[model samples]
Target chain A: MTGESLHLESVAGLVRGLAERRFSSEAVTRHFLDRIARLDARLNSIVTVTAETALDQAREADGRIARGQPRPLEGVPLLHKDIFCTQGVRTACGSRMLDNFVSPYDATVVSRLRAAGAVMLGKANMDEFAMGSSNETSFYGPVRNPWDTERVPGGSSGGSAAAVAARLTPAATGTDTGGSIRQPAALCGITGLKPTYGRVSRWGMIAFASSLDQAGPMAVSAEDCAHLLRAMAGFDERDSTSMNRPVPDYVAALEAPVDGLRVGLPREWFGEGLDAGVAEVVESAVAVLRELGAEVREVSLPHVGLSVPAYYVVAPAEASSNLARYDGVRFGYRCKDPRDLHDLYVRSRSEGFGAEVKRRILIGTYALSAGYYDAYYRKAQQIRRLIREDFLRAFETVDVLAGPTSPTPAFRIGERTRDPVSMYLSDVNTIAANLAGLPALSMPAGFTAGLPVGLQLVGRDFDEGRLLGVAHRFQQATDWHRRVPPGFE
Target chain B: MSLSDEQVSAIAELARLSVPRDALRGLAQELSAILDFVAQMNAVDTSGVEPMAHPQDVPQRLRPDEVTETIDRARYQAVAPAVSHGLYLVPRVIE
Candidate 1:
């Protein structure tokens, strides 16, 4: 098969191609590595391109296939968002603090995928420490949207989304603390799943918010996502919070009919702050779901608006605690000559962390500080429970909730940088899922003004199979997910 | 909701991040904007609601204390910015 042939193949397609000897895993891995080297500079989507490791892994996969003992993802190449610790690779987490920090161990997600025979093409760029919505916060630099180079790709999974959208890799792993996965997937016109919190292991996934962080798959279609999720999600003893529930056959459930499926349209999602174009696209996508025999109704999630505020409080509070481990004492960036531990801690952190990360750490410190913990942190936690309860009540009458994944399509980079709150609002529609600890997916719904829009479908906890099935059915009836970016093709 | 420069500096100090004199003013502005936004939570009467720690209320599982990990002190120290004889190096706390 030609190198271009690798672009159109799904995870399953690539696996089957390897099994059929249509192409060696080495060939497939090289094809993607070449694509990343050739195309990634234009998008700044890749931080590292591991050609040597990829080829070695691919060759191992080919040997396994030759022995008639193929693993599920044998020969499929993928990009991991730099947030996941890759054993020997520079898992920078898009921050200068860990710029030279080669991880000593693999994140569970990374090891699981490797065990399933997926080849790692290298790490994708992201918002520094998974803090931004626009991917512009990266210490390396912002990742440009594949559709329009001048525009931002939604982030902190922006690199993963753009890599998959541009077909640089067949699938990629992304972690969503808030909307990092789904928002980027929406903006980049790809499929991304943020499995129910605890559905995937957090061990070795650098934490931004312990309660909200979840690793999931970003791919071209829900079917591709399902295949990847099957390998990525499961119980891990390493992550104490990792759910022990049996992993469902997500791939087999992809073709399940959506007939009689209840899709609740949150009234709050369609209100003000939603771009008219995105809303129209989402409306038509809902129509397609309706056409496919799913019932749609407007449901009220009264506390949905509070998700942003509550998330700001909760995520930063957790971030402050999680990031404390990065002081000059252990690993990561350190300061020059220090007078004492005080100077070492302060200078190392202030100099090493980017502006956005510092802002969050400060916010978190303030929120969790002695006098303000109850008014800010505790209040936010109560609000989180309310948000979760709102979703539970909504789910009583609907199997999934549907909305526009982001308020708008990819905005121009630097548009919201002046106002951090504006940047925070980009996640308005996507944060509730994290707050509720529910499985949610964003898929290409349609394009607006030549840019792609995404429809977000959220499901009950551990109900990722049902969500994937719904999205797969939508992809079957619509060509949105198949549409490639202009020059990417 | 507004954070004074002194307050911003205090927060930065607590977070162990050195705030440059000029950056402090800007940090104060940004922090105030964020705090004011989240202050909307104060309006809601969470009178009886318990502050949630974990999303799922499941208690953390405990296992019999056993050695599950082998120490790779050298490998772990490789990434450290400064390390000494089987220990992480840090600025001297005592003269």
Candidate 2:
């Protein structure tokens, strides 16, 4: 196939093209560079573009081919979520606090991807410190949905999601603390996976909620994501939370049929705020699975409704502790008038953090405080157990859980910005997966009012391999993932 | 879940934030609404439930307690707002 055709090809096709030497890695890299130049200005989706580095890596990949060496991702170009720390490149994390900060070390995921020979296409923008569910909190500004510029692309991994959705990059890394990856992927109309917590290393990723943070793949289709994740995931000594379990060969079951597999739909997800269109799309997605030899059943995750609240308290509590280091004393934002260490700490953090971040931090601090610990924080933890139990029990009767990724499709930018509660609630269904520490994915279901809606499939812990298998099969049966945003093209 | 204005103000202080009085109403209302949603946990009976902090049952990976190397004073100071004699400079706390 020609270079133009390859640009829009799935990551599996890109890897195959590189393997056959049909077109040099440099040619594929340049084609995407040209596309980014043409379209990124309008969407502002990609914050830091690494054209020179990408070309350099492409040449090295071609050199390896000259020597008759081959690797699965030898020439694949991938973008990274700005949250991960790259040794030299600016990893913005969508915050002014670290706007100019350059990390001296690469996160385990970055190093692993590089070792896999994936070409770096620079870092994508995200919610500053990976804090917000919407990209608006980013100091770099909001990433517009590729489907419609007026709508949000979702966040805190908005840039990664947009980059994958618009075909600016084949695959990108995204961290989900409380639905960051899944929500954004759902909004952007791509397949995004959040491996069970600790399944992926968090070594140099700027911490959000340490307990909840997980990095995984965002791509046009599940098969592509499987390849991308295979390259980036594994246990690392540097991350205390990194799981030591074997990284399963995810591609083994890409074509596996799910005959009589039971899928549970949580009652909490379909309640109140779910827009008719999004609910319709997700319900039809369940039907598609039913037709493909799966059984759909309604299930109750009684405590699932409390996930967002538990998450708001728990994530912020962890974030507050993790981010305490950025007090203008070491790295990141510092105030101009710092006269002493205390002033520096107070001003640096107050100035550096955005409103939503401050709000969450407040909630977290209160939850963890002396008199309120049992009332807020400990109680939330107890509720967290019930959410996990709900999922665990449901899994005994179901192969997987299904739901709409968000209550609504991509909403107009300013519409939800004025209401933070609405924005936080947008992550409702997806948070339970994080709380349960289960692998969850968001894949395109269908469109509503011309914008794409996402369907989330959550599986038991360490079952991402099966989740991808299910998603790949679903993608084979559908064409929604192939639809591109009109203006973006 | 109905966080009062005083509660929001108190929490902000604990988190070391500087919020103006006028903004307290909005923050309180929003925080209250969010807390209301989170309060859904109160309806469930979780007496025997054990709270899980991480998804995996795998034990936390730990580094040996041994020191890796000497600290890089210069690099550490690079991001500091003000460092004097390998120390961060700060405002005077003296009376």
DockQ scores for all predicted structures: 0.81, 0.60
Which stretches of candidate 1 lie above 4 Å from their native place? none
lDDT of 1 at A454: 92
lDDT tens string, model 2, A276-354? 9998898888899999999889999877878887887788788777766777766778888776666677788888888
lDDT string for model 2 (B1-95, tens) is: 68888888877776767678899999888777777766766776667766666655557667889987888788757666678899876677786
Q: Write the per-residue lDDT of candidate 1 for residues A1-489, one digit (tens) a residue.
A: 576677888887887888999889998888888888788989999999888999999999999999999999998999999999999899999999999899999999999999999999999999999999999999999999999999999999999999999999999999998899999999999999999888999999999999899999999999999989999999998888988999989999998999999999999999998899998999999999999999999999998889999999999999999999888777888989988888898888888899999899989988898888888888888998998899999999999999999989999989999999999999999998998888999999999999999999999888999999999999999998888898888
Q: What local distance difference test score does each model get?
A: 0.91, 0.84
The residue-by-residue lDDT of candidate 1 on B1-95, one tens digit each, is 88899998888888998888987788788889998888877778898997777767877877679999898999999999888898887877888
Error of 1 at A112 (Å): 0.4
**Which candidate has the highest lDDT of all?**
1
- Residue A121 local lDDT, model 1: 92
User: Among these predicted structures, which one has the highest TM-score?
Assistant: 1
State the RMSD for candidate 2.
2.0
What TM-score does each model's chain B reach against the true chain B? 0.87, 0.88
Considering only N, C-alpha and C atoms within 3 Å, which residue pairs clash in candidate 1? none
